[model samples]
Target: MGPAAAAAAAARPQKASAAGGVPARWVCALCASCFVFGVFVINRIWSVPEPVKLNEKALFVERTQTRLSEVYIPCQRKQNSIHIGEILNHVSQTHDVIMTLDKTISNLEMRLAAARAARATKQEKSLISADSDIELSKVRPKVFFVMGIITAFSSRKRRDSIRETWMPHGENLRRLEKEKGIVVRFVIGHSGTRGSLLDHTVDAEDEQYSDFLRLDHVEGYHELSSKTLIYFSTAVAIWDADFYIKVDDDVHVNIGVLGSTLARHRSKPRIYTGCMKSGPVLAKQGVKYHEPEYWKFGEEGNKYFRHATGQLYAISKELATYLSVNRRLLGFMVHRSQCGAHR
Candidate 1:
């Protein structure tokens, strides 16, 4: 081979990468080049003068100080322009350094004036206040309630001791009212609350039951409106509540704790109250919201689907409005029971 050809062949990358099959020599060359370039960049950065930004007012002060040795004050004339003959005579009498300094000072003044005109908007006080109140009082309240009989739908022939769950809810509301001084509103949509005193719909009273009332308002749970579509219809009801919470008629919530937490976070813009969600549920137990597009639904480890079931959920006033206004925009799901994804 010719000398140049032999040199090029020797410099060429020969060995393949162990994993991705890229040339190993090329990788080494690239890494070495990056390292050298990084060092050069860092050295150049270190050598650069740390820039100091000066306010116009500050620079004006320094310029005023430099004018101290000169005897005559710069006279302000009322006429349209300064007399050039007078300025030239003054410069002729002054030292070259003073003349040079005066010229530099004049140039700085002219340039600063033009710059001030160009950048007047940026220099003016901002109309938007950083001091705006993010307090709850800034927004009108929106309250949503998950009023209904929410219990485990068990087809087991005998009932579980689950009926005992009602005692705490009534007592809980009384405690919230008497001790905390917040009125608790409960709406019951199902026929037999069985244990709830605040049952909004009664089976014997209404005959068919007002099951559709609460279900019509929520998304995934809209199935009373059609369980097969199974969007948790509960979130729709949240739009109505300034600060809405949807707990199962079964779960024991410490409203004192909940109220305090809510009060502390009253100023927060968006809040979704719950324990962090995790894992998967193929079982019809616990909480379930079917998401066909799970990957786009959340990050790999983040288990929140498009919605959660009625076990428990809470929304702040702002989020209630967001949910209400955007309900039409949210494309919900449809299910085919013959080929059930859950089963």
Candidate 2:
């Protein structure tokens, strides 16, 4: 071949070798730059601030132990103060004692309830037996008069006055009972003063006249409502009449007029016949018909509700029976006419 062509071929081999060397140098420079960048990032991460860690569980346990030693341990060491264990023991014992007392009270209450039930049953049975002798089936009474009077052992004068003035006796009473179907009875409670003497006098009076109904309860001014309840109960137990009349011994009633008025309203069982007083309740103490428990009437209104005057009133048989049967619930409220008797 010619010298120029041989030289051109040698130049092509040198250019190929140089191109291969350029790629190897570029790879080495890139590897070196990557290593420098990695070192810089690692140094920056190491230089950054790091948060300190604490053992929180151990700290909490230490604080709790310190509080216990300071408060509870000191309390226990004090001579005058009680310990937690002692207090706990005392509370447990007190609870046991209270529980025992509660059980005892419950037992007593149950026994009392049973006694009351037994007494009620006995009273009902006795009344039924007495009813056979009275021949209640044959002679059903139409009107029953229950007179309220406060009679003591020394108050024979009052009873005598009642008997002589208005109350009919012996054949007159029997004739009235047979013809008009009316019965009059005096209701009284046992006296506190001279009880035995009073009881003997009452017994003697009952033996002679047989018109007195002596209650088992002791007499007192505060027990006026209770006496009224007993009077109703006794009257209902004795007879199932059409109308029941309650009158004070001091008030004289015209039997003819009362019977006529009752005949007109006999069909109406939900009526109460009496002198109803409607006026403002007196707030001052010691006034006649003064309301001692004015607060029960409320703060705004000063007037009293229309209620039957305590002197005399008549109730239907149904109302009388209801009052007698539910005496325990109604006894306190039945006599709240002008003022509270309990007060």
Candidate 3:
């Protein structure tokens, strides 16, 4: 073989080897570039804030705890909204219930008021019907004995019992007044609250019976002496009677016997007749027939002077006139004298 041919063969082999090495180097370079790009992307993904990172497979960025918390907050807000709506619904239901209860109470109150008004109307009608047949005398007549029966507004049942038992009614009462010249009347006074139901009831009763003596004094248990004095004064003013008798509503008396008993003493000028009694003066409070001025009776545990029992008593015209004339002075004296007396 020649030397030139050998050199050509060697050049051909070198050229072929050089051409294969160039292709392999280009492939390596492309692979390295791809790796660098991937690395940069991974670094960018990992370079996020501390709470963000790549998943195990590096397929995508994992949602961090902070992002998950942010998502949960919206869900929590939705839940809270639902809870608030439920509370508002409950409040609305409670309000409806309360309104219903209030309406029911108002209805009950109105019904009660209507019932009370109806009852009052019925009572008024009954009273008017009861008084339809009564006829009363217009002129004041001369009388011999004036009997004042002390009573109170609340003593209607007691007065009824008395009228049913001993007191005359209808024509019999008129006959007694006309023939016997004995005036018997129930004495009462105005109530503390003027023009009240009590006063109206009393006025209605007086219109029906024509047997009530209305006084200007106020009715009270403590002012019994004043009441008695007023009764004497009023009886003396109205009638020319020989005797003025004061009797309690609870007392039972035979009118025939009382008339006879008074007739015997009619001639006396100044006679006071009653059952005499002596009772101890009570110093302590809250006791029955308690005397506030017990010290005026000399001492504690002392007894009152001899005096007539308050249940029934009679005073002649002269004494009654004196009592009427000196009412203020005698009233004070009588109050002092009867301070410790049994009621």
User: Comparing 1 and 3 by TM-score, which wins?
Assistant: 3
Q: Rank the candidates by lDDT, best first.
A: 3, 2, 1
TM per model? 0.34, 0.53, 0.54
Per-residue lDDT tens digits for candidate 2, residues 1-343, read 8999999998998898887775778899999999999999997887654321245666788999998889977666784455666888999999999878866764564345434433442355332454452454344345544334434445577667877877787778777776777777777777676457767778888889877766666777677767776676666655556677777666666778878888888655446778888567566767675565666667734776676777788877666665655566642432256532221
The lowest-lDDT stretch of 10 consecutive residues in candidate 2 is: 334-343
Show where candidate 3 strays beyond 4 Å: 1-141, 282-302, 331-343
Q: Assess candidate 2 and give its TM-score to the true structure.
A: 0.53
**lDDT (tens digit, per residue) of candidate 3 on 81-142:** 99999999999999999878866764564345333333332233222232331211112245
In model 2, where do residues sit more than 4 Å from their true spots? 1-154, 193-195, 279-295, 331-343
Give one digit per residue, the lDDT tens place, for model 1 in 1-343.
Answer: 8999987787665522245486779999999999999999998887664332346667888888868624234443322136766787778878777757765764554345323322331232322122321222233133323223343233111112222333233456446335544433333233243334323223232233212222212223443323211122233222223355645545665655766677776554456676544444222324355445545434543433434444666665445444433333545332221121120
RMSD of 2: 19.7
Model 2: pairs clashing at backbone N, Cα or C within 3 Å: none
Listing every candidate in turn, what is its Cα RMSD in Å to the true structure after a full C-alpha superposition? 33.8, 19.7, 25.8
